[model samples]
Target: MSGIYIHIPFCKQACHYCDFHFSTSLKKKDEMVLALAKEIELRKNEFENDVVETIYFGGGTPSILEISDIKLLIDTVYSNYKVVGNPEITIEANPDDLSPSLSFRRNLFEELKAIGVNRLSIGIQSFFEDDLQLMNRAHNADEAKRCLEFATQYFDNISIDLIYGMPNMSNEKWLQNIETALSFNVPHISSYALTVEPKTALKKLIQTGKIDEPKDEVAQEHFQVLVDKLSENGFIHYELSNFGKENYFSKNNSAYWLGKKYIGIGPSAHSFNGTSRSWNISNNSIYLKSIAENKLPSETEILSKNDRYNEYVMTGLRTIWGISLDKVEKEFGTDFLEYLLKQSEKFIADDLLYLDEKILKPTSKGKFLCDGIASDLFLLNLE
Candidate 1:
């Protein structure tokens, strides 16, 4: 089974730390929706042999769109694609957009369920007012709690995004954030450290000394707190940055980790088959113009053997799946497997990685260092 990702490229405000492509203006919303529908039709043939098992609506805040507009896009997919009988449909929303004041009029949560959206991934980065203002998030702390209260009443397949490691975030605040999330009894939580991406406001602030840089040690402490608390509460640390109760892992992201095929539609969306990958133009205006002219503004690349293997190691080491030596030997031949084993000896001896039969996985102490270890194990193309 395959998956589909729809990007909604509009937001009400720009978060200081976000580097994702999006426009804060809504002047072209209607036109962009039309262009998205056109793009879906244009790419349907790419997935002719696969039945869509998941439909994910991610973006510049998908909660900004009207329910009718969302339905239009879903209808386009249903009409053109071979989707399963009960595909998991998820929409990423922010707290302000789902607040009682805004949702009471339309009963947004119930409407979403009626229209086939089974899951909601709310962007509740923190449950503290200071952190919200510090990140310049569009919503306040009260709205965050209110939305979760409303959402849990209607949807059980819910996930919330949280952020840690802000310059001013203390351990107390970070622990409170986790406890606040638990208070809602959410089945899934996706949390990440505050990263300063180049060209983002956070980077500029740090460069000018307007804000302090995020401390790696502090972030590591926060991560440990997250893992311990969640594990004690019966949540599985299935992935480095994700925690879920039984049967509640994110199917869409899990498919990505497993290297399944998925078609991404809209500006800045990415698509991957087993052998190649492609991405749409990041500019909304250019994307709409191209779609209007019956053209796709995108670029594709065929993966090299080395590229595929490196990606496999990178993703595998970050999750419970680990790396399978047998699969490597079978798919990439003995030379590659031998090279991997030779390179892994030092880390294995240091207790950063462990070998269980034929599978290699990161030890608890090495989980935070998985990326670095994976890079060290990469094979430089000798050709």
Candidate 2:
């Protein structure tokens, strides 16, 4: 099945740890919206024979847009593509944008539901004031709690994001963050370690001693806590960093992990069609100009057999669906399968990975290190 992702490249303010393509200014928002719609129409031919199953609104902050604008984009998708019956439409939101009182003017949640937007992924990085300040989030701790309380009333398929392993954050505080998020009863929770990306304000702060670097050991401890607590709460650790109740897993993200084809619209968004991948320009102005000229404005890369194998191994090991030895043999031939077995031998011996029948899956102890393991198994393209 195929899906579509629309990136809204704008945010109220830049988070210290964020490096995503977004402009804090709203000067070109109107133009950007029209350009996004035109791009959707322009690229409709790519998915002419495919049925769109999920429409995900991700990025800098989709909630900042007007309700009408959000609806217009969804409408544009419908006009150009063959959408599935009751497609899983999701919008990534920031807590500050959600109304404190649902009865407020225009009622954002109600309007979104009216336009077929069924899911809300709120970016509730932390529930503590200190953590919020450290991350330079626009919303305070109160907004994070209040938004979820109001959101749960309108949307059943709700997901909230939390950041763990912050500098000076105790294990108790990290657990409290998860507990607070659980208290809201969101069906899905996506948590990640506070990483210091190169060139991000966070990296600068750490280098200047303004903020301490996030410890990897602390992140490992928090991940364990997250998995245990969510499992106790009846949420499945379906992927490395995602926990969701049965039947509430994110269709959009799951599709990506399963190697399903999807269209990514908007600046800096990436698209994949099985063998090839493309990404739009990160520059907002350039993306708009290109689309205005009726061009796709993206670079493409055709995947080699080795490239495909490595990707499958990486994505597969990160999810509940691990790499299938049988499928690898069938698709990539016996030589690749033999190489996979040889590469995974050390991990298997260490109990980091185990074979369930012919499917190779990561063990509980190895889940956090899956990415590293996957990388080691990658076949360097010498051809």
Candidate 3:
């Protein structure tokens, strides 16, 4: 149930709201491709005892890569690690890269399928021209529709990303976005609220009054609609932001949520191995040089007992798989368990949390605030 995440650090253009690590220029694309494969081969021993059940190509824009580059990377994974019979291989792509108008792009889906890629996570933030412009997405309204029209014919387990809480989006328009996505009949969807992160173009725009700030009340309204609409249509609200049909849940994401060990390759990527976590250097030049010199360009830290407990609480509260009260008592002792129940008393009394068969979970009223609630129960600066 382990996975590997490969970060692609190049994008055609920058999205206004994005604070992720990426370069707009593809000047070093060829060199990057080789470094990534070499890093994959270099880190094989770390997972010698674990079989990789998923391989996720995430990042600046994986769809921009040549099909040969993709094949080589997947092949490197096979050559180095013990992979499952049918691993869930996914690529995060933008619609501009998947447009069927270009000759090479027309064959992209088929070639990806031939090379063992079984899933596609398309970065389709919205379906309206205005929303697309606000987010500065690479694809327009028409391209989003056209790509899905063709992509659905090629890949079955496709998951598209949609952003809610845009400043000027109307309630009717938000619902329209949902309905249009439903029209595609895809099995999974991952949606998120558009937050103005610091240092990004989005934050600056908001500060200068170039764009209106996204309202929290509006976000809450959209979230309720998203959950109800998706659930009514047979999509399970498994994880807070992700909805999936039966047997179609993302294996890579599920493994990570359940606290499984995973190796992350490429610059600005993070990795966890049950007891500790590590992250690679964010600078591309440093990562390339280190890999060439047979060194891992990364930093590592071991998790303390309280840190592990805090992490479990944060992740558990956000998923349908609630925190197991029995496991808490068993692993963290009566003292920790008592502290948990005491800290959760107010939420439970407010009907925001409840105990079901000894498992602690958030009620529908509290799901949207799980992160805040979990923080209240954190084991911070205490024994």
lDDT of 3 by residue, 91-131 (tens): 99888888858565558888999999999999999999998
Candidate 2 lDDT, 1-383, residue by residue in tens:
79999999999999999989999999999999999999999999999999999999988899889888999999999999999998999999988899556575238888889999999999999999999999999999988888888888888999999998899988899999999988888889999989889999999999999998999999999999999999999999999999999999999999999999999999999999999999999999999899989988899999998988999999999999999999999988888998999999999999999999899999999999999999988988533
Deviation from native of the Cα of residue 128 in model 1, angstroms: 0.8
Model 2 TM-score? 0.98
Scored by lDDT, model 2 comes in at 0.92
- What lDDT score goes with residue 348 in model 3? 98
Worst 10 residues of 2 by lDDT: 99-108
Return model 2's CA RMSD, one decimal: 1.1
For residue 279, model 1's alpha carbon misses the true position, in angstroms, by 0.5
Model 3 C-alpha lDDT versus the unseen true structure:
0.92
Clash pairs detected, candidate 2: none
**Residue pairs with backbone atoms closer than 3 Å in model 1 (clashes):** none
- Residue 312 error for model 2, in Å? 0.2
TM-score of 3: 0.98
- Local accuracy of candidate 1 as per-residue lDDT tens digits, 174-212: 999999999999999999999999999989989999889
Local error of candidate 3 at residue 294 (angstroms)? 1.0
